[model samples]
Target: MEAVDLTAEQRAIIEADASDLAVSAGAGSGKTRVLVERYVQLLRECSIPQIAAITFTEAAAAEMRDRVRREVMSDPALEQHRALLDEAAIGTVHSLGLRLLREHPVEAGLDPAAAVLADDEAELLRRAACIEAIDAAAEVGGERTRALLGLGVYHAGLQLPRMVAQRDAVGAAFAAMGAYSADWPSYVRATLEAHYEPRQTAIRGQAEEIAWQIRRDAGNVTERLAEVAGAVLQPLTAAREAREWGDFAALLAEARSQTNLQSGGNAPAAVNVKGAMKELRELDDDAGKLPAWNEHDEPALEVLAGLRALFEDSVRRYEAAKQAQNALDYLDLELGAVDLLRDHPAVAAAVRGRFLHLMVDESQDINPVQAELIELIAGGNGDGARPALFLVGDARQSIYRFRGADVHRFPAQQALV
Candidate 1:
């Protein structure tokens, strides 16, 4: 109704009828006004009452809806469209996902009553399992197995529940800054590249050298066996021979009395070192699956497994609850929306068709997933055809890595511009 100061270039981009579109609205660049104008256009100019306005954050969505509502209340013409504005779908990606999940839980193979898993609970279960493996492996040899057992022992000794404060501090610090909360796997990969990979190679090389020395130490077992072949019933040499010649700790231990009778006074004190090593290895293999503190073999594997199962059951409950929640973190909203659009292409396309006049604020905060979701809805803008998108965001204000927001998406959008 009333013209606001806008460059002809801005007006052209906003009014363009394209299949796909992206607008790079810098901060304080009338981005919200652009969004409101587009909504008004759709309702008044395009006569589309049914529209969905999605934003990265619930706060942003609420802000936009409020401004639009304020406009509707003030303008007599828009006042008639106020009811339609009220009916318009406006939400964060996660809110939308939860809404859909509530409507279609069957599709996700999740019960409507499920819960979200708490990290502490998951950590507890993992620790219990790890400790069990370590205790079991204590009877074995080798630095690697020892290290595995040590992890279990460490877990057992910890007071995990008491460290809730520390855990929250860590989470807060991470969320306040850093990409670890944004894309965990990518962050881990970066960490490995910077620290672990080179160290791992060095450790492996050292292990090989140690293995060769162990083998050479093993050669003397046969000569010692010959010297004490008769005097000792089950010589240390024989025990060493059994362990070295073949993987036979259990085989050597069976009927120690019989072996002593056959050779006369020797049965090298029946130590199941090899069997312990095997058990240690089993724990080592499972340590990661278990907890960090309970990284041991002293605890029984069965006990650990049972505790782990309990923890997992709790975890399952927690996860289900979290998913069922109507609320979500910023990233969850984007991902959920992307999934919804991807799964229900027809519904998305129908929505997009109605919004040939879409405007987005905070374009810089849009991550890859959100970008894809917009693309799916808008079609391909640079190719040129309807409901072109006008996005306004200041790259400097684009500091939401905790929600996986990337500045890179802005550059890609720039090419389209």
Candidate 2:
């Protein structure tokens, strides 16, 4: 790490000690180089096994490991640490979780010999579990069963497996929706206000300006065009002042439906008045397009609730099948690792004690579950006494949403740190 060639930001990143950091660097801005330099600095005080450097893929992990090795080999003082690189936790988060689970299989409540299932094997198991859950639910014959059937069994059959595959994310969404069940109206109203209120305010100001100009230039403007401007301005004013969305929408509708303002001469005042009216009409047209949020029966929520029940049942069956076969899927690795860390205090303390620094690359793609696992291992809120957690990723490059990646978690974790 030569100071002569490094930028100020890079120097800050490398020199900053102990405090948690979330660095967002764009492509080719030497993000990887900065991360490698930081890792090298950590190696001066921490053993390879004491730090965790997690990325997205095997190739990336290999590249990062190679960079660390090269940096270590370049300096004579780091000779003793070179051999420990192979045992370092530098790989995908899933691989790290797998390592944790294998180390504490008894505490994790899993068979010591359980192997990770192949993609094809996991998909087959998911499909089987979904079918079994659907059949069992249908056999029970209840309101939910009827609701599930009403959504079309064939459609449910096609969609339920996909949903089951991402059960953790879907389950979390369902929980959030249930939490807001009593406040949907407030949520809807707030959303509407945030979006339309500003535009309405701008329109009101613009229309008022146009109205004043028309009045001041009344001697130059025709009487017919003045009447048209008055007609449009009245509703526009009412729409802007209306407190309720319904009243505002109705006013916009009335304004947009007014007779068109036409210019009969080349006079500048007539042309200005006509053009102003036309522009006002277009703006009101946009305002009128606001969606009316009328309360009605939401059958989809009921069907989704029923599907949610089936999804849970499917998950239980999936776990049972995996346990019977003595195998674990990728999801199982993370969930198991989290369970192991959170449920057993001794295991958690040992893990926290083992890793003094945690660094995650491409952290923007981490979902809530993975974030929770990171927190559990990092010893909670990253406050005093917690090991430093380094997160570096650009939110724009988050492309793993299908595997439950939520880009919002990046900023949120940054704020917490």
Candidate 3:
């Protein structure tokens, strides 16, 4: 209603109706204000149900709905649309998904009355699935499964639940890693390259810096202190030249093993050496203990294979278990919606036609599945007519990696926009 107080950038975001946009602004920069302003503009051009504002949390969605209502009611020109505000698609992505799945349960192949499981209930179901999967694997007694059992049933039981929880990520990693039955050393080397190289680089620099300090500090002390300093420096230097990460880990292990380096006659010198050794100990703690996969480590690889197989079994059983109880987890909601959209083009087109503007907030925390769902609804200028997707997020504020949030997607979407 008024452009005098709004900045040029805010006006641009509010007025950009045709092109997709990815906006990045820090906290307290009025991101929510921009979203509301944009939604107001979209509301003027389309019906209420044709606009969707997807937020990160339920509280955020509620706040957004309230703010939009306030903006609409505050403007005399927008009074005619006041009654339809509650009918707008304003909620979290999961909420939108759940709504869509409920609308088209037959297309999604889901039970119409399935309940969404709470966190505690999902954990119980996941654990039960893992236990059943392990029991089945033990019964089959394949070679790899037997090797996994060799690691001890207790250990398998402990580790499988974690694997089940991170099933999607672990499955992608395993697929990238190729067959565990391949050459063990080569497999280990590849794994190190993919995951451990960054840590190795950081640890190498830290160890060398500490070694330099120890050498300088020990020189003014006794010859015994100097000898102990040499002992620390040897591995530090060797670790620097190490061709493999396992060798570097071995060097740190050697440094860690030397706990009783003492000289009785020179108490002050011994104390000085001990202090420097204390820093080395701290360094060892920071140095990630890389797995030492030797050439003959076929059993360990077999165990990994077994674990992967068990995770597969567990996921199948877990879905079945949820189905039996007529319950679906959050993952099921997002993925089920994606499947409905992908497999049913008519349904996807119907939903797409209804929502001409798709706005997503806190988009940095979206995982691949969520991204796929978003793309399926409003991908691009494919048919020359679709919803214009507006993604707003600050990658610097992305902290949900453990929950499978990929901050990289924010910038990737920026490039597309």
Name the lDDT value of residue 81 in candidate 1. Answer: 79
Cα lDDT for residue 375, candidate 1: 69
User: How many angstroms is residue 129 displaced in model 2 relative to the true structure, after the best TM-score fit?
Assistant: 2.6
Decreasing lDDT order of the candidates: 3, 2, 1
lDDT of each: 0.48, 0.77, 0.78
Candidate 1's residue-wise lDDT over 200-253, tens digit each?
Answer: 344334323423332333333344433332222233234434422122223223
Q: Per-residue lDDT tens digits of candidate 2, residues 62-172?
A: 999998988888899899998887898899888999999889978987787778887689999999988898889889976449657777778777877777777877777
For model 3, the stretches where C-alpha displacement exceeds 4 angstroms are 1-8, 132-162, 175-188, 191-299
Candidate 2 off by > 4 Å: 1-6, 118-120, 132-158, 172-297, 379-384
lDDT of model 2, residue 389: 87
TM-score of structure candidate 3: 0.71
Which residue pairs in model 2 clash with each other? none
Model 3: lDDT equals: 0.78
Error of 3 at 40 (Å): 2.0
Candidate 3: how large is its RMSD? 6.0
Per-residue CA lDDT of model 3 for 390-413, tens digit only, reads: 989998888768667799877866
Question: How does each model score on TM-score?
Answer: 0.46, 0.75, 0.71
Per-model tally of clashing residue pairs: 51, 0, 0
